[model samples]
Target: MARTALALREAESAAGRLRSELAAGDEAATRSAGSRLAEQADVARRHSDGWGFAALTHLPVVGDDVDAVRRVARSVDVLGADALPPALGVLETVRGGGLRSEDGGIRLDTLASVSGPVTEAHDASTRADRAVAGVRSDRLVGPLSGPVADLQQQVQELDRSLGAAEKAVELLPAMLGAGDRREYLLVVQNNAEIRSTGGLPGSLSVLRAEDGRVELGKQGNASLFGLSADPVARLTPDEVDLYGRNVALDLRDTNLIPDFPRAASLMARFAEQRGQQVDGVVSVDPVTLAEVLRATGPVEAGGVRLDADNAPRLLLNEPYQRLRSNEEQDAYFQEVSRGILDALLSGQGDQLELVRVLSQAAQQRRFLVWSDSDDEQRRIEDTPIAAALPRDEGISPSVGLYLNDSTRAKIQYYLRYDADIRSLGCTAAGRQQVVAEMELRSDVPDDVARLTEFVTGDGTYARKGDDAMNLRLYAPTEGRLQALTVDGEPAGIKVGQDGDRQVSVLPLTLRPGESVRVRALFETRPGQIGDPSLQWTPSMEWGPTRATARNLCG
Candidate 1:
C-alpha cells in the first residue's frame, strides 16, 4: 500500500513537470519528465493491481475511491507511455502552421491527418471520466475525502476539455466549409447597455465561409430586425413573466433571457424573418475584441485607432459619448466591429494567440456561439462556448446573478459587481447552509445627473445617471431561499423557479457612487457539493470579486 501511494505521488508530480516542460518547448526536459512519469505510473499500476490492493478496493466507502485511484494510475500510465508522443507531434504540426494553406484557409487534409492524436487523448479522457464518474465525496472518510474529490473533479474537467477539443476537430472541416458554403451571423454584443448573456446585440454582420476561407458579408445594426407586432419567435410564459414581452418583441432584448442558446435561437429566427439564412450564430463582446486586438496590433475603425488598450473603452463607453442617437451609436458600433472583424479575418497577427484569447473569452462567457445543426450543437452543448444557463447536471451546483438594464440608457458601462458565498455548515444527510451576499456599485461621478442625456435616459425611470436594472439571483438546483435582505433591512423578492433552481429578482436604481448590497440565506439541497461557485454577468472591467469556501460542510 505504501509503495503504491508513493509511486502515485511521484507519478503525479512527474506529470506536472512534463506539462510544464512541454509548454516551455523544452523537448529534452519533456522527454525526461515523460519517462519518469511512465515509470512511476507503471509501478503504481502494477502494485495497485495486486491481489492485496484488489481486495482492499472492495472495502466500503473508501473502496470506490480506492478503485478510482487505481483507474487513475492506469490512465496516467497509458497517457504517459502512449498518448503524449502523438499529441506532442500534433502540437508541433499546429505550431509550425501546418494547418494553414497558401491562401490562408485551413488545409482540410492537414487537419484530418493531425486529429489522430486528439482522438487518442479524447478516448483516454473518456475512460478516465467513466472510471471516476458518480464519486460521492460526501460519503468518504476523513482526510481521504478531499484528495479523492479533487482528483475526480480534475478528471471530469479534463474530460470536458478533451471532449470539446475532439469534437471541434471533427466538426472544423465541415464548419469551415471545406466543400460547401456556410453563412453565420456575427453579432457584436454591446456591454454598455448590459443584457443577461453579455450585452445587447448592438451590431451584426454576415460572414460567409467557403472553401475554408472566410469573408465578411453585409453589415447591419439591431434596427434591421424591426420590432414585431408580436414576438419574432415564441416564448415561454416564464421568460415573458420574468423579463417581459419586450424580451421577445424586440431583437435587442432577445438576450434578456440569459441563456445564450435560447437567445441565439431567437436571434436566428429573427434574422431568417429579416431575410438572412445563417448556419449558426456567434456573439462576442467588446472585451473579447480588446483581447483580439492584443494579438492583431492596432486596427483602424471609423477613422479611429483601436488597440487592446482603448478598444474596450471606445466600444463600450465612447459611442455614448460621441454618438448622439441610437442610429449613430449603432453605426459607430458597426464600423468598429466591422474593422475588428476585418482585422481578425485578415490573418495579420499570431493566429495562435488569437485562438487562445478567443478560447479564453468563451470560457469567460464574453464570447458565445450557437449552431443550427443539431449534431454540431450536440458536440458543443456541454462546452463553455454554449454559455447556457446553469443546469442541474454538473458535479458542483452553480449560483448565478444576472442583471438586465431597463433604464433605457448606456449607464451599465460604469457598473461593477462582487459576490460572496460561504458555507456555514450542513446536515448529516447532505443539506447545506450558505449565505450569499452580492453588491453592485455605480462608478460614476458625483454629478451623475449632469452627465450626457443619452447616458442618463433623461431620468424617466430613475434619477439622471441612475441605472435601473432588473437583478436576479439564482440558488443551486433544489435549494431554498430562506431569507433575503437588501442593505441591512429585510426585503421581499419575487421568487420563481428556472427549472429546479429558485430564482429571485428585484429592480432598483442606484445613484452615482451609490452601491446596493444584497444578502440571501440558502438551505442547499441534499446532494453532492464540491468547491463553491458563482456566475455573474460578464462585464468590460470584469470586477467580479467572489469569495467562496473550499468545502460545503465544516
Candidate 2:
C-alpha cells in the first residue's frame, strides 16, 4: 500500500508538471517530466502486482483495500506506459523539426508526423479510462482507503486532461492550415466595456496562416464596419424583442447573440463587406493579452512599455486618459496589437511561455474561437475555447450571471462584482431551488468627470462618475426563475431567451462610491446541486475573484 501510494503521488506530480510544460510549448521539459512519470508508474505497477499483494487481496478483511491499491496502480501504469509514451513521442517529433523554421515558415511535413503518435496517445487514454471505471472508493475500508480513493480521483482527472490534449493535437494541423491557407478574423475585446460574450469588440484584425507562417493583415476599430440600419440576420423573436433591431447594427454588438458561432458569422459578414473574407473568428479580451505579456516579457507599443503586471491597466484604462481623440486611441490600440504580434512571430521570447499563457487564457474563457470549417469547429465544440454555454444534459445545471455595460462607456473599469449561490431545497416534483445574489459596486472617483472624453464617454450616454449596467442572470435550459429582487425590493426584470438559456435582465445605475445588491431565486431540474462554479467576463486589472457558496443540501 505504501509503495502504491508513494508511486501514485510521484506520478501525479510529474504528470502535472508535464501538462504545464506542454502548455508552455517546452518540448524538452515535457519529455523529461513524462519520462519521470513513466518510470514512477512502472515501479508502482510492479509493487502492486507483487505476489504478496495478490495473496493479500484474496484474503478476507482487507481485500477491498488491496483491490483499490491494485486498481490505482494499474491506472498509473497504463498512463505511464501507454498514454504518456505516445504523447512524449509526439512532443519529441515537434522538437526535432515540426515547429516553424528559421525563415519563419512552418514545415507541414513535420507537423503531419505527429498524427500517428497523437492517435496512439488518444487510444491509450481511452483504454486507461476503461481500466479505472469500475474502481470505486466505496469498496474500500480503513485508513488507506481515503488515500486510495484520492489517487483514483487524481487518475480520472489526469485521464480527462490527457484526452483533451490528444484531441487538440489531432485538430491543430487543420487549424494551422496544413492542407491550405486559412484566414481568420481576430477581435480584441475590451472588457472595460463589458458585453455578454466577454467584452465589447473594440479592434479587429485578419489573421492568415499557411503551413506554419502566420501573418496579421488589415486591422481597424469596430466602428469602421459601419452599423446596419436594419437587422443583418434573422433574429429569434426573443432576440428582436430583448436586444431590439440594433442587434445586427455593428460588430460591437454581434456577441449579444451569446452563441459564438452566431456572433462569429455576423462579424464575418461585416468583414466580408470590407473585402476581407475569413474562414473563422477568434476573440481575446485584455486579460488574455495580459497573460501573453506575462510569457513574452515587457514590450514597447505606441511608445508605451507594457509588462505583464501593467498591460491590462494601461491598455484598458490608460488609453482613455492619455489620448485626447478617438482616432489617436484607435491608432494606439492598433500599434499595441501589431507590436505584440510582431514580437510573438519574431520568436524573441520563450515559446514555452507563450503556449502556457494561451492555455491559461483559454481555460478562463478569455480567449474564444469559432470556425466556419465544420471539421475544425467540431473538434473544438466541446472545448472551453468554443465559448458555448452549458447545454449538455449530463452536465450539472448552473446559473449564469453575466454583466453587460448599458452605459455605453468604459465605466466598467470602476465596477467591482461579487456573487453567491445557495442550494435551498428540492420540491416534490424533483425541482431543486437555488438562490443567487450579486453585488455591484462603483469605485469611480467623484472627480472622474474631469477626465478625458474617452474615459467618461463625455456625456454621450451617462455622466462620467455613474455606471449604468444591464445585469443578466441566466438559468439552466430546463430551469425557471422563481423570484427576483433588488436591494430587498421587488424589481421588474425583463425575461428573454438566448439559445438554450433563460435570461432575466435587470438594469442598474450606480453613482460614484455606490453599491447595489440583487437577489434571485430559481429552480433547476432534479439532482442535488454539486459544487457551484462561477463564470464572468474577464476584467482588465483584476486577477481572479471567487465567490463562496452554501450547499444547503448538506
Candidate 3:
C-alpha cells in the first residue's frame, strides 16, 4: 500500500515536470521525464492489480475503495504509457512551424506526420476517460470523492482535446486544399432577426483554398437575392411539417431547422444553382467574428470601425437603424464580414490564441463547419461544432428550446431570451422528470415607435415594435412532454415531430417592455439517468449568459 501511494505521487510529479519540459521545448528532457512518469504509473498499477490487493475489492465495505484505487491506477497507466508518447509527438511536430509555413499556408507534411500520433492519443485518452468515469460516485465519499471527481474532470478534458486533435489532423488537409482546391460557402447568420439555428443567413461569402492557403471570393448578402422558384432541396416530411416549406424556398430561412449540416446542404444547393461551385459550408455569426477580433484587434472596414466589444451591436442592430436602405445595410454587413474573413486568412494574430478563441466560439454554436463529403463530415461528428439536433443517445438524452422570429424586422435585437431546466428527480425505473422553462422579454426602448421605419417592421408582419416569436421545446429522444404552461396559464400547443423526437410549439407576441415565460414539463425514458441540458438558439448575443438547466438528481 505504501509503495503504491509513493509511486502515484512520484508519477504525478514527474508528469507535471514532463509538461513543463515539453512547453519549454526541451525535447531530450521531455523524453527522459516521460519514461520516468510511465514507469512510476506502471508500478502503481501493478501494485493495485496484484492478486493480494485485488482480493480486498471483493470485501463488501472495502470493495468500493479498492476498486476506486484500481481504476485510478489503471487510468494513470493508460494516460502515461499509451496517451503521452503520441501527444508529445503531435506537440513537437505542430510546434515546428506553429502550424503555418512562411507562405502563410498549412504545411501538409506536418499535418500528415501528426495524424497517426493524434489518433493514438485520442484512443488512449478515451479509454482512460471511461475508466475514470466508472468510479462509484454513489459509494465514494468525502476525501475519496474530491480527488476522483477532479480526476474525472481532467481525463474528460484530455479526452476532448485529443479527440479534437485527431479530427483536425484528418480533416484539415482536405479543407486546406492539400492536393486539391476546395471552395466553401461562408454563410454569416444574423441574430437580429432570429431563426432556429443562430439566425437568418444574412451575409454570404465564398472561401477558396488551394495549395494550403485560403482566399476570400464572391461576397454578397441573402437580402440582395430573391427566393428560389423551386425548393433548393427536398426536405424530410417532418422538417416540412414542423418548419414549413419556406425553410427551403427562402434563402434567409434555410437555417430555420436545427440540423446544421442539413441546413448547410440546402444553402449549398442554393449556391450551386446560382453557378457557384461549393465543396462545403461554413457557418458563423457576428459574435464568432468578434471572437476572431480578439487576436486581430480592431478593424476599419466598409465605413465602420469594428472591434470585439461592439461587434454584436454594430453588426446586428446598428446597421438596421443607420443604413438608409436594405441594399445599403446588406452591402455594409457583407463588407464587415469580408474584412474579418480577410484578416483571418492573412493570419494577423497569434496562432494559438486564434485557435482557442475560435474553439470557444464553436462551443457556443457561433461557429460551425459542415462538409458535403461523407468521409469529411464523419470526421466532424460528435464534435461541438457539428451542431446537429440531438437524438436520444443512452444516458445523455438531449432537450431543445429553440426560438424563431416571425416578424420580418430587426425587432429581435431587443429580445432577451433565457432558459431554465430543472430535474425533478428520477422514478423507480430511472425515468427522470424535468421542467424546461424559458423567459423571453422585450428590452425594446420605450420610444421604440420613434425608431427608423426600416428598423421596425414596415408594419407588414406585425406592429412596428412587436416581436412575433415561435418558441419550440423538444422532448428527449423517446421522451414525451407531460404538460405545458405560458405565464402560469394553459395555452394552446402545437405538437409535432422532428424525426423520432417530439416537439411542442408555442407562438407568442411580445410588445415593447413586455415579457412571457413558458414552461414545459417532460419525462425521460427509462434508464435515462444522465444529467440534462437545454439547447437553445443564439439571439443577438451568441453566448449563454443565463442558466439553461439544473440537475437535482442527488
Candidate 4:
C-alpha cells in the first residue's frame, strides 16, 4: 500500500510538470516529464498487482474499496502506457513545426500517422474515467481516504485533458483535407453588419487544400453574387414570413436556421449560382479573426497593419471611411482576406498558440465548419464547431437571440447587445420556466448621418443614421414563450415557428446613444432546464455578453 501510494504521488507530480511544460512550449521538458510519468505509473501498477492486494477484494466489508483501488491502478497504468505517449508524440510533432512543411502545406502524412495512436488514447482515457468513477469513497476511511479521493479526481481531470488533445489531433487532418483536395467556401462574416448566424457575409474566400497544403482561392464580396430574387430552394411558411419570401435573401441570414448544416447548404447554393462549387462552408466573424491575429501577430493588408486590438474596427467599420467607393471597398476586403490567409499558411507564427486560440474560438462558437463529406461532418457533429442548437431534453436546451440589419446598411457596426437567461423553476407539468433578457444599445455618433451612402443604406429602408434591426428570439424546440415585454411594456411582435424552435421577432429603430431592453418568459417541455447558453450575432466591437442561470431541476 505504501509503495502504491508513493508511485501515485510521483505519477501525479510528473503529470503536473508535463502540463506546465506543454503550456510553456518547452518540448524537451514535456517529453522528459512524460517519460517520468510512465515509469511511475508502471511502478504503481506492479505494486497494485501484488497477490495480497488482489486477495483483499475477496475479503468482507473492504472488498469494494480494494476493487476501487485496483480500478484506479489499472487506469493509471493504461493512461501512462497507452494514452500519454501518443498524445505527447503529437504535441512533440506540433512543437517541432511538423504541422506545416517548408512549402506552406500541412504535414498530412505525419498527422495521419498519429491518428491511430490518438484514437486509441481517447478510448483508453474514456475507460480511465469510468474506472475512477467506479471508486467508492464511502468504504475508505481517515487520512488515506481523503488522499485517495483527491488522487481519483486528479486522474479524472488528466484523462479528460488527454481525451480533448486526442480528439483535436484526430480531427485536424480530415478538416484540413487529408485524402483528397477539398474546396470550401470561407465566409468572412461582418458582425458589425449583423445577420442571423453571425453577421453579414461581407466577403467570401475559397479555401482549397490537398494532402496538407492549403491555398486561398478567388475572393469577392457577398453582394457580387447578387441576391437571387426567387427562392433557390423551397422555404417553409415561417422562414418566408420571418426572413423573406426568397431563400436567396436568407443566404446572409444564416442564424435563422440555427442549424449550420442547413445554413451552409443554402450558402453553397448561392455560391453555385455565381460559378463556385464548394464542398462545404467555414464561417468566421471578426472576433474570431481577431483571436487568430492575437496568436499570428499583426498582418498588413491593403496598406493597413491589422493586429488583435484594432482588427475588429478596421475589418468591420473603418472600410466605410478608408475607401471612397463600394467597388474599392470590395477589392480591399478581398486583399485583406488574402493577406490574412497568407499569414496563416506562411507558418511563421507560433503553431501552439494558433492551436490554442483556434480551440478556444471553436469552444465559443466563434469558428464554425460544415462539410459535405459524411465522415468529416460526423467527426464534428456534436462539437460546437458544428454550430447546431442542442435539442436534448434531459440536458440543458439552448436558446438563441439573433439580429439582422433591416436597413441594408453597415450600421450594425455601432450596435452592442447583452443577453441573459435565468431558470425560474420546474412547472407542475414537468416543464422548465426560464426568463430571458436582451438589451441592445446603439452608439452611432450623431454626425454619422453625413457619412456616405455606403455607411448608411440608400435611405429607403431606414433613415441614413438611425439603426434599424430585426431581432429574433428563439426558444428550445419543445419550449414556448409565455410572455414578452419590450422596454417595460408588452410588445406585440410577430411570433412564428421555425423547425423545432419557437420564434418571436421584434422590429425596432434606435437613434444614436439610445438603448432598448427586451425580455421574455418561456417554458421548456419537461425534463429540461434550458442549457444556460444564449446564442447571438457575433459583433465587431462587442461580442455577445452572456449570463447563465442555475439549474432549477436540482
lDDT (Cα atoms) of all candidates against the true structure:
0.76, 0.72, 0.78, 0.74
Ranking by lDDT: 3, 1, 4, 2
TM-score of 2: 0.82
Which of candidates 2 and 4 is the stronger one according to TM-score? 2
lDDT per residue for candidate 2 within 165-227, as digits (tens), equals 566666766777877899999899888888877788998888888877788888889866647
- Put down candidate 4 lDDT per residue, 1-554, tens digits, no spaces: 77777776777677678666755567788778878877887887787788988898798877776677667767767777777676667677777787778887778787777777767767877777777765655356442355456556566556655555566667777767778678889888777677776777778888898777888887778675537776666777877777766555646665556567777878888888878888889887778777778667999988899898888778777888778887988898788767776887777588877876665566566788888778877776766677765555555766777777888878888888777888777877768888888888988888975666776888899988889988888886768888888899998888888877888888889988899999988888777753355666555543433344545654
Q: Which 10-residue window of candidate 1 scores lowest in summed lDDT? A: 542-551
The positional error of residue 385 in candidate 4, measured at the CA in angstroms, is 1.2
Distance (Å) between predicted and true CA of 165, model 3? Answer: 2.5
The numbered model that scores best in lDDT is 3
lDDT: worst 10-residue window of model 3: 545-554
Q: What is the lDDT of candidate 3?
A: 0.78
**TM-score per candidate, chains pooled:** 0.84, 0.82, 0.84, 0.77
lDDT assessment of candidate 1: 0.76
Residue 207's lDDT within candidate 2 is: 88
lDDT of 3 by residue, 46-99 (tens): 998999788988888878777887787788788888988887776666545467
lDDT of 4: 0.74
**Residue 545, candidate 1: C-alpha displacement in angstroms:** 11
